[model samples]
Each structure stands twice: as C-alpha cells, then as structure tokens.
Target: MDEKLSKLVQDRVGGAQPVCLFAYDLDRLTEHVRTVVASLPPRCRMFYAMKANSGERLLRALAPLVAGFEVASGGELAKARAVGGQIPVIFGGPAKTPAEIEQALRQDVTRLHAESVLELHRISEVATRLGRIAEVLLRVNLAGPFPTATLAMAGRPTQFGIAEELLPEAVDTARRLPGIRLAGFHLHSLSNNLSAPAHLELLDFYRRTVRQWEREFRLEVEVLNAGGGIGVNYADLDEQFDWAHFARGLPAVVDAFPEHCREIDFECGRYLVADCGRYVVEVLDIKRNHGVDFVLVRGGTHHFRLPVSWQHSHPFTVVPVEDWPSSAPRPELRDAAVTVVGELCTPKDVLAREAPVSRVRAGDVLVFSHAGAYGWEISHHDFLSHPHPEHVYYGDSA
Candidate 1:
C-alpha cells in the first residue's frame, strides 16, 4: 500500500475528522474473484462490471484477473480503454443513441448487448453505415413473478434483457440483419443471487436455444454471456461465499456446449469492489429527543448516496478518535443510543434511525461498511454542491 493511503486508512480506522474510507481487502476480494473465475468450466470468461466502482487504483488491481470489461455507456468504455485494458468489452444500455452505437462499433468492442428491438435495429444501421459487422448479443428477460427480498433481478420492472420468448426471434433477426452478427446471448435477470440451479437453468436454456438455432437457422452460437450476479455478504461480514461451489457448477454449463470454450462471459459488478470500500463520516451535534438520541454527521445521501438510491441499509461502527480517549482526550462526548443524521438539509438524508451509538458530538467519526458498490456514484446531485468525497485505493492486502 502507498504510505499515504495506509496512513489514511489508519486515520479513518482511528482518526478524528469524518472521512469516507474506501478500500476493499484486496486479498479477500481477489480470493473471491479468483474463486468465481475458477468455478467456471473451461472457455468461460468473467468481465468486471466497471460502473460498480471506477476508482483507478482498484481498476488497476482488478484488470489483470478478470476476463473482460462489462460497460454500460461510452464514458465507461473510454475509461477502460484509457487504462490500457485489453480485455474484450461488452456494452449494455437500452437508451443508447445512434452516436453511441456508432462509437461502439467503430471501437469494435468485444460485444454490444442490445436490449430492445429499436436499439438492435439502430446497432445494425450503425454497423451497416460504417461498412462493418458489429459483434452483438441479445439481452433476455427471464424475470420471476415476484421480487426476491435481496437485490435479485427476478421481480424488478427491469428494462434490461429481452423477454425469454423473444430471444429466439431476436437471434433470428440478428442473423438476417445486414451489419450485425449473432455472436450469442446476454442475460442479467437474476442480479446478485445466482445459485447453482439458477446457473444450470440458464445454461440449459441457452443450450436448448443453441441447438435449436443450429438446426433451424443454421447459425452457430459464438458467445454465451451468462451474466454474473454473485451476491456478497453485506450484513454478515464473516460468512464467505463458497466460490468453489459456484466454480464447481461452471463446468456443467461449459461441458454441455463443448465447442464454445472460453467464449462464455460473466458480467460481475459488486462482487469485485463493494467489499473493498468504506464510508466514514464525522459526528456533528448530538441531541436527545423523546426517548432517542440523535448524532448528526457531516455527510448525506447527496454525498454517500447508497441508502436512498437502492433502498439499502448499511452497517455502522464507531472508532475512538479524540473524544474521551484514555490519553488522547481531544473533542467531546460519552456513550448512548443515537440516530445518525447527515447535513444534506433533507429529512430523507438520515443515515441511521436506530443505531445504538455513543452520545456523539462534533468531531467524532463514524464509519460505514459495504459502501463500495453504488455509494457516491449512484444518486448524486449538485443540490447543495457538496464537494465530492476523496477516494483512495488501498494497494496492500489487509
């Protein structure tokens, strides 16, 4: 780890000022990433979803391991390219304009995962106009009837993948299109709860589709993007996912297809970087109202931006900074139950409504975990024009 970064992490782990501490335990993160990679049968590729976290240091650390990049926009594509990343890149976004399609085709991205019929047509048009063939995959929607409690893709009104029924037709349409090739299929229906059965079902679905396509359309499938949604432990930090179990299941999916080894890609996002980051905020004023005490902080949803955007509830812990220290007595405060609030000037900017924290006062710092996923980048606005939080990556394994 850089000395500066190590000092910063130490400071947040024990400092006074409110700091958004963000660093994944790289050893643990890599263990998880490698396990996920190892689980796949031969020929399957895993791509890190870049929108999850764009910290340059983290990207540099993760670039060498994952198979490719799964980007949703042109800006993300540019960032990946700027870092001298050579992995195949896949673009996924429904409202892509003509210009974006043209740029993607020009760059010859690994694959463009087109969602809607209109976007598919636009990609074809752009490829035809550019006198090129855009390697593409059709997104499929295999959503379940009800929403799963966690952030699974089953029940959301997801405008992401094409309906399962429409996939075959979409594949046939791609075969007929002038400027596009039916490279394969793309799916992200189950967001972060991918069990072995889910993986098997998805692979089987594709296997049947491939056989049907080969027999009827005479088209061979080149790519099978079993989109990634491996869930991480946000609530319980101790229970590690058995990536070996997941890896054990990959071969079944790969062996079934036989020919397309290494062509299957996993679009993983949160599993790669969420555990690596932390958000630290300072305790401001402390007040007691009714039966509950409130500890105000210097950050908000406008700054951290996770609780509000994704309806997420993060875990909080306190580190002794200056206040009431045995020998480091500096600021102010004692111990009591308190709710944490931010300075966003919005009632909804509440960090925690029921945390049993100490009777905190101005200067004390509180740290929150699982902040690396959609923390600052999600629902940010210039509402109060708060300065963006400083993002530092920890290079050394913790």
Candidate 2:
C-alpha cells in the first residue's frame, strides 16, 4: 500500500465491526489528474468521462484540470455545469430525450454525439425549436480488425453508435437539417483497453477513417473523439495502463491527423481516478465452512460491485485490529487462504476468493485497492436496505 493510503486507513478509517467506508485522497487525485493533463500535447484534449465516478467532489476537483467533462445524460450535464460552469462539456448517449437535446443546446454543449439518424432528426427538431444551430458529431461503430478489449462497443453488436454503412445517409441528413452542423466523427471503439501500443494503433485507425470520411463527404472535420478506453489493472497493480508511454506516443498519432481537425479528444474515466480511493470494510465474522475458510465483511457487492461485475477477485489487504470488546474468544486465520465475503445472504457476495491472508480476526478491516472508479457509482446501495457506507475524504474536495 502507498504510505499515505496506509496512514489514512489506519488513522482515519479505523473502527470496530460493522464499518463500511469509502476513503478518498483528494490531493492525490488532483496531482494525478494534473500530471495527466500536462502530459498531453496542445492539440490533444483530455475530457473526464463523468460516468465513471460523478461525485460532486470529484467533478469539482477534475473540472479545472481536465479540458472538460464528457457527460452522457441531463443529470451529468447539470452536475458538470454546476461544478465548473465555464468548462466545456460534450454530450453522448444512445438515447437522448427531446428535453435533453434542448437542455444541451441551452447549456451550450460543445458537441452532441448522435448515435443514430433518428437521433440526428431529434436533435435537429429540438434545435429548430430552440432556434439554435446545434453542433453535432456522428458517432461511428466501425467494422474493426482490432484488439480485444475488456468490453467491445464497436467491431461487435452493441447499441452504442451508428453502423459503418449508414454514415453517408446520416451525414447527408445532418447537412440537410435546418439547425445542425456536423462537427466531426466520434469513434469510441472499446472499453478498458490496457495496451499503449495497441491504443496508438487504434488512434491511427481513427485518423485514417476520419480522413476518408472527410474526403468522401466533402465535410470539414473539426473534432475527432477517440473515446475513453484506457484501463486499470486490478489483477496486478504494477501492470497498470502505461499512460506515460501512451502520452509520449500519442503526439505522433495526433500529428498525422487531418490538418482541418481542431482537437483530438481523449475522454478517460477509469484511468483518471482508479488509484485514489479505497473501499474499507470491517470483518463481521470468521468461519471455516466445508473445509474452506471464509472471512465475512460488513459490506458486500451492494456497496462495491466492481469485483463481481468484472468477474475478478479484487485485491485487498487485511488490516489487523488487536482490540476485542467481546467476551468470547477471537477466532483468527493463520497463514490460510481465506475467501472473503460480504454481509449479503447470497453465495455470490464473494470479494476475494481463496486469497492468502497472514492473519484476519473478526474485528479486523479489509481495504480494497484500485476502487476509486466504478466503486460506489455503479453499486446498488439500496439493495437489502442496509445502511450506506460513509464517504470520508482526506482533503476538502468539493
């Protein structure tokens, strides 16, 4: 564990049983985001994808460092604008209500990614009603001979963007629309991509495809959004996405892009905030059932669902607590591989399966690492009606 994080876990999050807490180091998050921002070239813009973790504190801290926030819904747009009103916001979603289109125009979004031709018509109708020319990007789901990522939005059957063959029709419709300007293309191909070299290749693909589109459509492309897919390695912390190497090689990809293109946007979410937060929970019970040691914690997938959702046993550390307020003997696991589970009734509430733990008592705490992104944001907090965990920030984030 990082020294500061260890200190935070020991000093701030320490408590008795039935404790579930989310501890965030805002200063570390700010520094990390600033470093990521500085590494980018002039033409490359970094937009924080708010879908990963849309906490107000996170938005407020990230609003200044990032180029803008890439929002997907009206609520996200409102949150981004409320945190940093002057910062640019780009909206993208498969389904955009007419009310949302009007809101995006009224709030002055930089670009709205049209997922389908019908969505283009929707934007045009709403824009005409508002008497505003809406700048839009036709999101493309490319036919790919591409790398296999954690999740495939493009090069596969997905409801994310428009199909490759339908682009021409969408372009013509956008041009003929009364209150719309086709800004450029949005090629958000993958999710949770870990390879830097492969990502560079992906960028090359985007540049070539966009260039071909500009030539065929006779349209001047301004912005090419190579959507956020950079990943965090939960299996091995040392093998995280090579952002430095990716940043170093990104300029070459951007330099070869169309001269008419103004900005190449990288709206990263997980890569920005995955290392700054932790899910700390207290041990509720320790048992050996059917020759398997199980350490049950107070919280479960309802509070932190990344482990089950990703189908991986998340890494964690056992922080031993010496205090025992109970009169009964304290049971402990010694040099044993224990399966860590949560308070949920279902057998699917496992966190780490058969993981080696030196020692874990009933009153100890388990600190889950790399939990900053998609931790609480993607969880079902109200399932089972259990108490929500406490959010403890090390620094003033909001």
Top-scoring candidate (lDDT): 2
List candidate 2 stretches off by more than 4 Å: 1-17, 396-398
* Cα misplacement distance, residue 108 of candidate 1 (Å): 2.3
- Tell me the deviation in Å of residue 69 in model 1: 0.8
Collision pairs in model 2: none
Model 1: per-residue lDDT, tens digit, 255-275?
Answer: 888474338777878777777
User: Candidate 1: lDDT of 352?
Assistant: 65
Worst 10 residues of 1 by lDDT: 146-155
Model 2: lowest-lDDT 10 consecutive positions: 8-17
Global lDDT scores for all candidate models: 0.69, 0.88
The most accurate candidate by TM-score is 2
In model 2, the number of clashes is 0
